[model samples]
Every structure is written in C-alpha cells, then in structure tokens.
Target: MTSREQPSRKRPRSEDASLKNSLSDSERETHEDLIFIRPMRPLSVEPDRDDKFWYKDGNVVLVAGNVAFRVYRGLLASQSTVLDDLCSADPAWHVDGCPVVHMSDRAEEVRSLLSVLINGKTYITKREVSFEDLAIWIRLAHKYRIADLLENSLRRPSLQSPHHSITAVNLARLTETSSILPLALYDCCQLPVETLLNGHTYPGGRVEKLSADDVQRCIQALSVLGVQRTLAIVKSMDLSACGYSCRFECADHVSAIKTELLEDLKSPGCRHPLCSWARFMGQYNRDMTSNVKNSAHPMCPRCIKTVIQSHGQVLLECWKNLPELLGIEVEGWATAQDA
Candidate 1:
C-alpha cells in the first residue's frame, strides 16, 4: 500500500523580518524630515561694524577663531610670505561670495598684526608696549614671517620694571630673541629667587610670570653673581682715603659698610644693598653728565665717586660674563652697549 504523503508545512516568518521592515519605515521618515528641514545659517565671525579696521568694501575677510577681520589682501601679501602662499593656494574660501581666509590664531593677535601691516603703525607704540603684548607681537610676527615687524618688536624699550623683567627674560628665552637677554637677565638678578619662582602680584592682581627653568637659572646665576658682587663692593672700599683721617674711625666706618652689605647678602631681595648700589651708580652716572647733585649715599662725596666707578667696572665684568653665567653662548646675544 502506498503511504499517504504528509502535508507539506510552510516555515514561519522570522520576527527579525518584521523588525527590519519597521526600522526601514522609520529610517524613511527620518530621511524625509531631514530633506524638509532648513539648514542652519553659518555663524558670523565678523568683528563689529564700528571696528577701526573693519572695511565694508573689503575684498577679503580673515577669520581668526570667532573674530573676523576685513582687510586688503594686497597689504597682507606685501607683509607676509606665509599669508601670501596660503591665500594663493586656496581660491575658494568665501563667505557670502566674499573671499575669506581662516587662520588658527587669536583674534587679538591677528588684529594687532593686521593693524601694523595695514596702518603702518603698531597698535601699541614701541615705548609703551607691555611684556605680554610685545611677546604676542613678536611671536605672531615670527609665525607670519614678517621680518620688519620682528625687527620693530626688538626695537621696543627694554623691560623697565623688575616684574616685567621676569616676563621679558622668559619671553626672550622662549622666543629665542637673543637681543633682549642681557638686560633681562641683569634685571632678573636684582630680584629674589623666591619672587622669581612664586611670582610677585601687582596692585591689580597681575602676577609676574616666569618658567621654572628660568627661575632656576636666575637662582644659579644670582648665586654666582652674589659672590662676585660682594667681592666688588669690598674691593671698591678704600679705608685709608676716607675724609676721617683717623685710622680707627675710618676702619670702623669701613667695617660698618661691610657689615651692612653682608647683612643685605644674607637676605637679598629687590631692595638689597647691591641693587640699591647699582641704582645709585646709575643715577650718579646720569647726574655726573648733567652736573646735578642727586647723590643719596651717606658716604663722603669722594668715597661715593670712587665706589660708583668701581661698581661700574664690576658691572662691566658681569656683563661680559652674563651669557656664560646663564649657561648660554655669547654669539648673537644682545648686550647693553652703553652698559
């Protein structure tokens, strides 16, 4: 007998098939929504309309971060090879059909650099530039390969205050601006190592800034110079030549001066006797040229004159060895020629 063929059974559809179909419908709806949605407007990076450098008729816009500068392309090209090459390579950077160039630089820095290039004058005059501003200007000038700006940056007044001196030293070292090193290092030697390391806060909460390595160098250099300075002061004293002809009185006076100087060495700070002597000598030299009487020392006039001359000689020796003391080379390093 022939067995009845078993009825064929159909295989059940997988739950995965239904899930996939639902996902496809959802994806289709999402795509349709995306197609209907309007694109967000591009953010405007342009500076204020009232900005001094902002030109309504400018042919090119330079965007540095969130700020945009409207300036002449020819001016930038004339000043910087790097900028010229960048703009030349990219002909399609535009905003609202106006050619735009994007730069990875701070707006303030770009503004300063552009101001100088366009106006033929720096935003801050060379005599009034702060350490921070000078540092930024020099760095940007170097980065943009603007040799004129770099040279102009170097011509700015050397650090005038001890706090700025710390900043100058670090900036000079960081930027490899060898021309500013000698004076900066000399100023640093006037300040205490603690002040150099921890920094001194100004009246407005602005703190003097220096690198750890620079602080260490200052400490080492000052330590060496302290010995040299003490020797200079002692050698400069002439006990026999004092107005007081009595040997005992002159001896006592010399001993007192030595004692005070030694005490200052024990707790050297910005106001240390050595710094005071340097300042006094500086003033004396200036007064001598002007024939003015501004000597503040209690020592006799003859003694004071001799001491200033001796200090001058000592400072000359220090200047000659300054680069070596700081563990750097003398070649290409700047020194105060008048020093």
Candidate 2:
C-alpha cells in the first residue's frame, strides 16, 4: 500500500469508534467483508549482521524497523532509564532464545545511539558521526532520556560550524539545547535569506532544512544587522580628529565609502575595488574586531585612531544587543573585548 493510504497502527480508539458510528449499514457490511477476506501474513523478521554494529556474543537483539542489532542489554539499560523500565516491565518477550526489543526508530538512528552507549564512548568521535548522524542521535537521545548522549551530541564540533548552523538551530530547537541557540542564530544571521529558506547541502552530502520560524528569525536578524552595520559605518566616518592637511580629503573618502557600502548592501555580494566599509561590515558580520590600522582606505593617522576607537565602541554596543537582535536569550556571551 502507498504510504498515504497505509493504516495507522497508533490511531486513537475514539477516532476509530467515531468512524464506525458514522458508517452506513452497507458500508459497515462491506468493511467487515474486506477485513474478513484480506489475508494477513506473519511478520517477516531477520537479524542484521552488519559488521559495524552487530556483536556475536551480545545478549539482546534490538529491532528497529526491518534491521536487527545484537547488543548488550545491560549497557543500554544502565545508560537509558526508558530502556531500563522496558526491560524491567517485560522479562519474557523473547525471539529465537534472545530478548527482542522493538523500537519505532529507524535502523541508522538506533545504530548511532548504540555507537555511543555500548562502545564505551562519551561522545561519538567527529570522524565517526556525520552531520545527519549527529542530528538523529540528539533526537533519539532526547526521546530515550539519555542525558550524556544528548549533551555530547550538542557539544559536537559539527554543530558549531558555519555550514551546519541551520541544522544546529533545528536540532537545538528539537532537543531544547538553549545554550547553542544563540550561537546558531548568530550564524544564521550571517547567511543569505535564500540559503536560509531553501536550505544548504553540506560537503558531506547532508541537506539541512531550516524551519519557517528559523527563516523568519534570520530575516529579522539580518534586517537588524544591516541597520547596525550602517550605523557603525556612519559613526566611524567622523572626521573631527583628522589633521588640517587631510581633513577635507578624508571626509570625501568617508562619503565615497558609505555610498559603496550602501550599493553593496543592495546587491549583497563582494565587488572588485572593495570599499573600506564593505570590508569592515564583512568582519563585523562575522563578529570579528575591526582592524582600522590595516584598512584599505587612505586616512590620516589621527583619523585612523579615531575610527578604530569609534568602531570598537560601536562593536561593544552591537554585541550587547545581539541576543535581542536575533530574538533569542543568550547567557554568558563574550563581549568584543573579551573575544
């Protein structure tokens, strides 16, 4: 049967009773005849002897979907309270002389969970778990109340990378990992709106989807970031500290820089003969400190010092309000100075 037409095993009894009550006499007869005439086959079960996860001496067999994993019962029970309760509640559900625990999770998800639990590992090593594996692991960990697994999954380096920021946001929301949300949201702010809405595929062949809410947050944050970037650029263009010889030239240079920045904002791409404002905003968006001394613009030494100090102050203000800009509450974020 097609997935859409497949019967739901977990459908509520109230819905089933309501449907039965609504059926006409002829419809009821036809439904009963259909049920009586259809042949039901015994469930086809088999052991998955994949070398990656299967253990010959394991005590319990975990069946997730069509795949079976032979793993230690004690390890799983000790690590997961839900598993412990299940084993304690039913001591007699056995298949082929070994206890069989049927799980609703997919085979790969179960394998990822077991990789962390039974293998004497605190976290799945970066080499072992891909972005997709980490996402699934966090979900299963939260479902099964595996605290260590959930924590480790959140702490994985993959979640902190720029490429996986959207995935991190989705996983953070799913697992309620509040600490990672602010950083993930900040990273989302750096991405383009189209990339945020349509999702980006990582180099490892994992496609990450951002929710509509996440996309909206990015949109709002990007708008705020643009305003902040413009304000910072305009504030740094103050030429009062310029020397008498270069004051007028510096003022005109700053005006040209502002115009270039505004044009770049409209196009949202790097251009040849990159403007000072564009470079500064690029560093600013990445939350990096501005290096006025190395800026491409020609400014008097005194004016450069003034620009540096003003940009520093503006960056501090932006950092202070970053959480508010992203519509998230962040705790213990380092200031620009601290960074």
Candidate 3:
C-alpha cells in the first residue's frame, strides 16, 4: 500500500492539559498565536411557548425563531400546499404530545398568517389592510401557498405612498401579480438615482431595494419618461389653446402656464430625468390661482379651460400607456379613462 499521511485531529473546545504541559513557555506562546475557528452551529430548534397562539389541544408545534405556536395541522394543511407537505413528513423531534416543526420565519410573520387563516375577515373589523400589514400578510401567504389569502391581500392593498413602491414591486413579482407593477415601476422611475441605490428603509429598519434588473429598467425609464413629459406638455398646449379672443387677450396668461410647466420639468439635483417635475405640480396650481387673485394678468376662464382640459386628456392617454413606457407588461391594467 502507498504511504498516506493521516489527517490531523482538531483541538477540542476545552484546552488539552497534556498538550499544554508538553510545550515550553516560548513554544506555548507561539502555539497560542494560532487561532482555532469554531464550526458554525445549526440553528436552534427549541423555542419558547407563545403567549397568544399556543393551544392546549394543538397537535403540532410550529417553531418560528424563539417563539412556538401550537396550531392545528389539519387547518394549516387544508389551506396551504406547502404546509400540507410539511405536516405529512415525519418530524425528528416532538414537544409535549405534538410534533415540533422548525419554521425559518419571524414570529410576527407567522402570527399574521395564522391570524387571517383562523379568524378569516374578523381579525380586523373593517378589513382595511395597511401597507405594512399588506407587506407582512402577502409575504407569508405566498410562501405558504395560501392562494385565497394572497388574493384577498392583493384586492385590498392600501399602499398609496411612493415610499413603499419598491416593496410593492417586490411583492408583485414574488406573487406573480402584474396589476400593481405599472404604478409601482413608475414610482420607482420617479426615485432619484441615489435613493434607488441606497434603497428605502421600512419601520423596522429593514431596507427594501429593487433587483438589479429592476434598477436597469428604472434607469431606462428615466430618459423615455423625460421625453414623454415634454411631449405631453406640448400636445396639451396645442389641444387646449383657445380659439378667438381669449387666446389673444389672455395669451400672456397661457404663456405663464406653459412657462411654469416647462420650468418645473427642468428641476435639478440628482433626480431621475422627469422625477422632480411632478413634485412641483402643486406650485403650478397655486401660481395659476394666485395670478387670478392678484388681478395682474389673469387668464380668461376659457383660456384656463384649454390648458386644463387638453392637459388632462393627453395625461389620460399617457396613463394608459404607462406600463409600456416602463417596459413592464401589466395585464388588465386600466385608468378610469378606460372605464
């Protein structure tokens, strides 16, 4: 047989007294310089009893993080295919008379999912799902394959702010729900390059970011949206320009609206193309009203109607084609104009 070198034995966690005794003081100091890295330990399976979700007659114990929820296996299996498969597997451990199944999820996430599964719509009196609540509910619902609950969450989304737009996009992608992507992606396009890179932090200090592909798509949207915004402004002016006397009499007033609109679109800073334009829209509205109030060069009511109506019409068309502009395809997407 060819001579083979034996593998060296690893030092025990406790220092070896015989090995220490065998070394001289200088040798021991040199040996002490060597560091022994401990192997990673497995995640803890043992969990503390949950105060609210634990039941006396529960047959299976779901351990999430450090909390355990003893809920019915039958009920969970009935609602979730993933849970059904998990329940059928033979558990390697048991707690009380119940089998202990380790769940790699936060305790709160598990609790939210269970709350809806058990209580149905009565969990909240009005069933108004907040953005945070929707986020928490949808993630676990999709992970567990609870189709009904996922559908329920999608239908009642209350995430009306741009702050959670990235989270909304992620959730939509995760659940394959395309209806939310158009608005969410448009909001993402509005974010500054810096904000897109740094990402938005939620209430719990968790940072939400777009995927690399989404970042690329958002970047692509910036220039296209800038061009579209300019075109829409131009088209609105054309369609809304009044016919005879009002057009000439309030020409300066119409000119002011166009000037402010164009200037608003040219705002600086690290904004993504046309992003800052929408931010100052209220300023335009204020200026229009204040000019009339000052009696300086008030636009005729008809002249004002031209700017407003044609602008609204052009924007309605833009809204319809928003998904296409961002290179996202959202099936069954429509603004009220379509309705």
lDDT of each: 0.60, 0.62, 0.67
Error of 3 at 286 (Å): 11
| Pairwise lDDT winner, candidates 1 and 2 | 2
What is the C-alpha lDDT profile of model 3 across 1-339, one tens digit per residue? 111134223454354456656878754553342222111343355678988899999999887778989999877766765565555545657788887776766787888777877887555336666777778778877766567777778877484677788988899898888877877888887776887777898767779999988888888878778777777667655523345564344665546666666888777522332232332333333336654332544545555565666666767777888888778777766554489
Q: Write the per-residue lDDT of candidate 2 for residues 1-339, one digit (tens) a residue.
A: 011233223334345456556778854554343222221432365655545766778888777767878777767666765565444433335555667666666777788777767654444763656777778878777766678777777777663456678878888887766677766777776776677778888655557878887788877776667677777767776766544455335566556666776677677722112123333434322123355523444544544455666677777777666667667775666453266
Per-candidate TM equals: 0.66, 0.63, 0.73
Off by over 4 Å in 2: 1-42, 45-47, 87-96, 121-133, 159-163, 192-195, 198-212, 237-258, 269-309, 331-339
TM-score of 2: 0.63
Which of the numbered candidates is closest to the native, going by highest lDDT? 3
Name the 10 consecutive residues with the lowest summed lDDT in model 2: 1-10
Candidate 1 C-alpha error for residue 184, in Å: 2.3
Task: Give the higher-TM-score candidate: 2 or 3.
Answer: 3
Q: Return the lDDT, model 2, position 315.
A: 72
Q: List candidate 3 stretches off by more than 4 Å.
A: 1-46, 122-125, 238-240, 247-249, 269-297, 331-337
CA displacement after TM-score superposition, residue 141 of candidate 2 (Å): 2.2
User: What is the per-residue lDDT of model 1 for residues 264-330, given as tens digits with 9 covering 90 to 100?
Assistant: 7666452222333645543433225453433322344445565666666666666677788877665
